[model samples]
Target: MPRIGVYNGFDPVDVCSYCIEVLKVTAMGRASLRAMPLTHLKAYLSAYGLRGPSHAVEKEDYVRAVLDARQSNGCLPRVNEDYYRRHSIPQPTGERPKGFLARMAESFSDFVDSLPQPDLSSHAPPPPPLPPRQTAPRPPPRTTANRPPPSMPPRPQATPGPSNSRPAPQPTQSNPPRQSNPPPPPPSTQRPTPQPLPIDNLLTMKPEELSALSIGVLKAILQHHHVRIPQDALEKRDLVDRVATLVEAARAEKEREARARAAEEEAELEAQRQALEEIERKKKAAAQKDDTGASEGQASQEEIPVAVPKAAAHAAAKLERDGLCVICQDEDANIAIVDCGHLCLCLGCSELVMQSSKECPLCRTRIVTSQRLLRIFKT
Candidate 1:
C-alpha cells in the first residue's frame, strides 16, 4: 500500500474535495496546486489518485496528473464576455451610488401620499339660506275723537287795606351762672445740664493701660477731637501716641501763637535732636552688620577643627565593627585562628583555609588550631 499524507487533519480526498468545492480550484489548474508548499504536492496528487509508477513523485508529474484529472472530469463553466460588455455599465469614478438616495426619496414620497388629507367641503357648513324679505307694517290712520277744552283764565282778586296790629313779646327766661377757667400751670424752675467727661493724660499712660480701654471708646475719642490716626494703626500704643502728639501739637501751636520767639527756639532744638538720633541709628546698624559677619567667619573656622576628628573616629569604628574578613574580603569575619590570634576569616573562608593550609593569612604564622567565634550581640 502507498503511504498517504494528510493535509490540515483531513485525509487527501477531503482536502481535494474542499479545494474544488469551496475554493473553486479546478483540478487541471496548477495555480491552485502551487498555492500550498512543494512538500504538500505529493499529498495533493494522492488526494485525486494521481500517483506515478514510483512512490516518490516529482512536482511536474504531480501537476500534470492534476491537470489530466480535471480535464477528464468535465468541461468548465463558460465565460459570457459579450453579455457583460453589452449589459454591464461602469459607474463614474469617485461618485457615490444614487440607488440609496433614490430609494429614500421613493419611501418619503410614499409616506406623504399615505398621510390623511383634510376635507375642505366638510370643513365648514354651507351658509344658511337668506331669510325671506318682509316690509314694515303701515301706521294706523290719525283721528281727533277726544279733543280736550282749552284751560280757563284764572280769576283776579281785589287787594285788602293794611291793619296796625303788633305781636305780643314772649316772656324772657333768666340766664345760667358762668364758671371761670383755671390759671395755667407755673413754668419749670430748673433746666437739666450735660456734664463734661474727664480727660485722661495720654502722654503719661503706658501701652498696657491704653490697651485696657475698649477699641470703640478710643476710636470715638479720636474722632471727636478731630485727631487723625493712621488707618493701619490698629495697635493700642500707636493710637495712644497719635492722640498724645495731636493734643501736644495743638497746645504748642496755641502757645506759639501767644509767644512766637519761644516757639522758634523749641523748633530749632527739636530739629537738631532728630538729626542726631538719625546719625546714631545709622552708626549702630553698620556696627551690627560688621559684628555679624565676624561671628559667622569665626564659627565656620571653629566648626572645621572640631568636626574632623569626630568624623575620622566614626569611620574607623565602623570599619572595625562590620569589616569583611581579610582572607576572602567577601564576607564578615567570624573565625579567629589559634596561635596567630587574628580574626581574619569568615566561617567559609576559615574552613577552606584550614583544610588547604594551617597558616594564618595575616601573619603567615603556622596555625595549629582554628577557633570559630560565636557572633557577639551588642547591647
Candidate 2:
C-alpha cells in the first residue's frame, strides 16, 4: 500500500497568481499613480472607466483605490505607454505636488473642478453679427468746363463807410496753449534669470548632462564650484569645457596632495624605525660593556700585580697583541698620541686621560694632540 502524504496549504498555482497580482499593482500601476498630480490621476481613472476619488479623499487613498481597481480588472486597461500617449497623462511640464502648500493647492483645485460649472454658451449669447457698414454712393468727378461758378452775395457799400466809426473794437482775449505730458519711456528688456535645475547631483553629472543646461545655469554651477570662468568663454559649449577642465585639474591636485601626505607619513615611519634600531643597538652595547666590566673586575681581584721587572717587555707585547688600551684596558686602542706615536688610549678614555694629565700614558712625553687611528690586521 502507498504511504499517504500530508496536505500542506502551499499551492504553486495560487502563489503564481498572487505574484502576478503584486507585480501589476506595485511594479506597474501603483508607482505611476503615486507620481501623478491630482488632475492627471483623475484623468487616468476616467480613462480606465474607474471611479476617481472625491475631493475630500486623500491622495494615498486614491492611489490605493486605483491599484485595487487595476488588480481586480486583471491588469487590462493598463497605464502603459499607449494609455499615456492617448490621454496625455504626465505632461512634460507637469510636476507632482511637493510640499504642504502644493498639496493644499492641488486639493483646492480638485474641489473647484468638482463644483458644477454653468453653461457659458447658453447663459451669455453671442452678440448678433454687426450689420454690414452702409457706405453712400460716390458722386462723379466734375471737369473744369462743366463745374458751376461760386455764388457771391451783394456787398453793402453804404455800411462800409460807417463801419470804422460805428463798430468799437471788442476786447480780444488770448488763450495760452495747453502743455502735454511727455510719454513714458519704453519698457526695458530684462535678461532671463537662471533657474535651479531639478537635479542637484552636480558632482556625478556628466558633460552631456551639464551641456543640457542653459548658459546662465552653467555659470551658476561654475560659481557654485568656485571655478573661474574665462573672459573669452561666452558660449555654452565653452563654459562646459571650462568646467570640465577645472574640475579635472582640482581632482588631480587633490590626488597629488594626498600622495604627498602619504609619502611624508611613510618617511616619518622610516625615520622612527631607524631611531628605534639605533636605540636598541646602543642598549645592547651598554649591556655587553657592563658584563665585560664585571668580568674584568673579577679577574683583577683573582690575580695580584707583583713586581715583575723580568716579564715587563712580555706584558707590554701581550697588551699590544690583545688590542687593549693601556689606560682603560676594556676598549680597543683606537687613538694615537701625536708626538709619542703610541696607540695606548681607547677613544673613550683618550679624552679623559688627556684632560687629566696632558701627556702620553706610556712615554710620559708632553702630548701635543691626540688622533683617532684605524688598525688593519692580516689574516
Candidate 3:
C-alpha cells in the first residue's frame, strides 16, 4: 500500500520554532498573549505538554505555566506527522487518459504555428491624410439708431404781485361773526336703555328668552345681587340656578353666624356679671369676718399661724421622689421610650423592656427604640 500525507505541509520543526518565537515576543511585551481566549490557551498548553490546574486556574497563571514549559523544553513538543497519515487513503499512480477535444486542439495549434509566414514588406501602403473642416462666419451685432435725448425740466414762474385793484374783500366780516358754535352739533341721537330683567321675571322666563340676553348683562345682574356663579355654569338656566342657590346659602350662613356671635357675647356678659356678684359676696363675707375678729382680736392672730396643714408638705416631698425609675427605684428615670416618649424607666430597665416586650410599659405603644434624656430633672 502507498502512503499519503494527510496534512500537506506538516513541518513539526517549523511549528515548534514559530511557537517558541511567539512566546518569546509575548514575554518581552512585544505581543499580548493574555488577550487569547481560555479555551484556545488550554488547547495550546495541552499540545505543548504543559500541565495546568484542572479547575479555576487564572488566566495569568496558565500563561505563565506555558512560558515556563517553553523555557525548560526550549520549544513546543512536536506532533507525530506519520500518526496523522495512518488513516489517509493512498494516491493513484497510473497516468490519466486525455480527452478527444483536448488532443484535437493541441494538433490544430501546432499546424497553425508551422504555416503562419505573411510577407508584408512589399504589399503594405501608407494611410491617407484627412481633409481640413470648414466653419461659417458669425452675424454682426444690432445697432440702436433713433433713441431721443432726455428733455430739460421747466423753470418756475414768478409770483404775481397782489394787485391794488381788488380791496381784499373787506376781511370777510372780521372772523366770520364767530358762528355761535354751530348750535351745539344738533344733540346726538340717544340709544334707548335696555330694561333691567327683574328676579321674578328671571325665574319664570323661558330658556330661549334667557339665551337671548347677553352673558355680560346676566353676570352684572348676578353681581349686583351679591350672587356667585360657577365659572363652568355656561348655560342660561345653570347660571340662574347656581346664582340663586349660592346667594340664598350665603344669606342663611351670614344670619346663623351673626346669631351665634350674639349668643357667645351674651354668655360672656352673663359670666362676667356672675363673677362680679361673686366678688361682692366674698367682700361681704370678709366684712362679717372682720366684725367678728374685732370682737375676738387675740384668737384671730393665733388662728392665722395654724392655717397651713403639715400633711401638704409631706405630700409634696413624696411627689418629688417619684422622679426616680419605678423599676429600680434607685436611679433617676433618664431613658425615654420611643414613639411614646415616656421617661418612666432608666437606661438599664429600658433595654430589658425592649428585649422582653418591645413596648412601652405604660402606654403599650410599640417601642422601636429608646433615647437617653440629657436632663433627667425636666418634666
Candidate 2: misplaced stretches above 4 Å? 1-203, 224-232, 294-379
Candidate with the greatest lDDT versus the true structure: 2
Candidate 1 lDDT trough over 10 residues, lowest sum:
370-379
In the range 173-242, model 2's lDDT, one tens digit per residue, is: 4444456889999999998777544323654678787778777887775554334566887577898786
Clash number for each model:
0, 0, 0
Q: Model 3 misses residue 237 by how many Å?
A: 1.6
TM-score of each: 0.15, 0.24, 0.22
Tens-digit lDDT string for candidate 1 (205-261): 655665676655676555544345567896877766655554454445345334544
TM-score of 1: 0.15
- lDDT score of model 3? 0.53
Q: What is the lDDT of residue 134 in candidate 2?
A: 44
Considering lDDT, where higher is better, how would the candidates rank from best to worst?
A: 2, 3, 1
Error of 2 at 1 (Å): 99
Q: CA lDDT, every prediction?
A: 0.51, 0.57, 0.53
